[model samples]
Target: MNTSAFFEKRVGWTKYTMLLVLLVISFILDLIISIPTLTTTPKLGGIRGTSSVQVPSSDRIGMERVEIGIGIGASEGCMWYGKDDRQCRYTLSFQPSSEFLHLPPKQNVTKHFPDGQIMATCHINTALQAMVTTSFIFGPFFAGLLPFTMILLPITVFMSIFSAISLLIASGQVAYHLKYSIPSFELQWGINSILPFVVVFLQLVLSIYIGTLRCMMRKKNPPPPDMTDEVRLEERPRDNTLG
Candidate 1:
């Protein structure tokens, strides 16, 4: 049987095409998630008479706002509460604090704070940065392997497991930080932060399915008989006829 015809019948175009499409989507999603601007919120302080400050988006991976300060004081506008008193005007700002930027190909990070005090500490930022890096590296590579299904199967399985583990670790860290961190400020997770896990999982499943299909095709369609064997058989029949 012709190799092309066998592949067309067994593997089909749609299966691999869909796999390629999924891979591309996963790659793009990983890149988007890697950007630090995905989440932003106002950091506020104080129970009564609070002030709010907009935290800047992180420039590099693993960078986050861990501490904020708000000041409440009297302004020129007076509504009159009593004989000698003033209304409050809230002023908001972020205090200098330490941040870890876990860029790729680097392990050690430097810490700095103007006041020599650590306001908050959270390792979730580091874990998330690592997860984003992994996805960024593997997503494109997996997509590239789609044309070579035989090679892709084992690698995809490994990647799937790695990605799942990374997701769990990152998620756990985030949960821990949220639960234990400052009560006045809350960190909100954006869609970009969560999309990569879902995409990686889908890639893993598709890789397995495609790999299985390839294996079945190979089993069902054995290689064509050797030309040399057919020639020898024909020659032997002629020899017997002559003898």
Candidate 2:
């Protein structure tokens, strides 16, 4: 069988197309996480604190409950009077993590000033940076190119594996710091933290499956049966008929 034909036939276009879809989803999710503008409320919360700032609406001073948004690179937060009401004119500023990705790292929300305003700063780490960079590189640009060029199978596999492992390490670091390092803040984790892992997992699965299929196809196809000797032996039957 023709190598290209066999590849298309055996693997089927549907699965390959699915790979593209998955990569697209992964890239979008990555972008969603990397941008600091959007904040998602987790079903389970993280790093909760109370500030006795005066309520914006009324002179009645009440304890404002603040919760840090759980995120991979950066997070935004909201202040609440109670579970039902939001404090007015609230602003949560996250110190930018790195100029490279422009995402704020794991946040530390503190009230050090006399005004009772929460100052949020990034605790930047290498692992978080790695995750962001990996997503940017492997997400859209490479994903678009991969479907056209089948030669990149091995490279994609290696990159996906590296990305998954690095993300795992980064996630562990974030979890450890949140649990032990910040005792004063109540830690709550939400969908933001888990979404990146989902992306990595999808990439890993796609890369490995496609790579393995390519390898197996190569072994089965076997290089056109080496016709050198057969060509040489094709005799001069025409000469015998003429004689």
- What TM-score fits each model? 0.42, 0.43
Q: List model 1 lDDT by residue over 1-243, tens digit each.
A: 345545557766666467656655655654443322211211111111111223344575553443322211110111112223223222111221112111123211111111211111112222333343344334323433224544644454455445545544543443343234333224343353355457567666666776677567657743454654565566674444655
Candidate 2: lDDT over CA atoms?
0.41
Give me candidate 1's TM-score against the actual structure: 0.42
Off by over 4 Å in 1: 1-6, 35-148, 182-184, 220-243
Point out the worst 10-residue segment of candidate 2 by lDDT.
113-122
Model 1 scores what on Cα lDDT?
A: 0.38
Q: Write the per-residue lDDT of candidate 2 for residues 71-169, one digit (tens) a residue.
A: 333334444433444422223342211221111233232212112112121112223333433443343223223343344433443444454455445
Tell me which residue pairs clash in candidate 2.
45-188, 46-187, 46-188, 47-186, 47-187, 47-188
Q: lDDT of all the models against the reference?
A: 0.38, 0.41
Clashing pairs in 1: none
Taking every candidate in turn, the Cα RMSD to the unseen true structure, in Å, is 16.0, 11.0
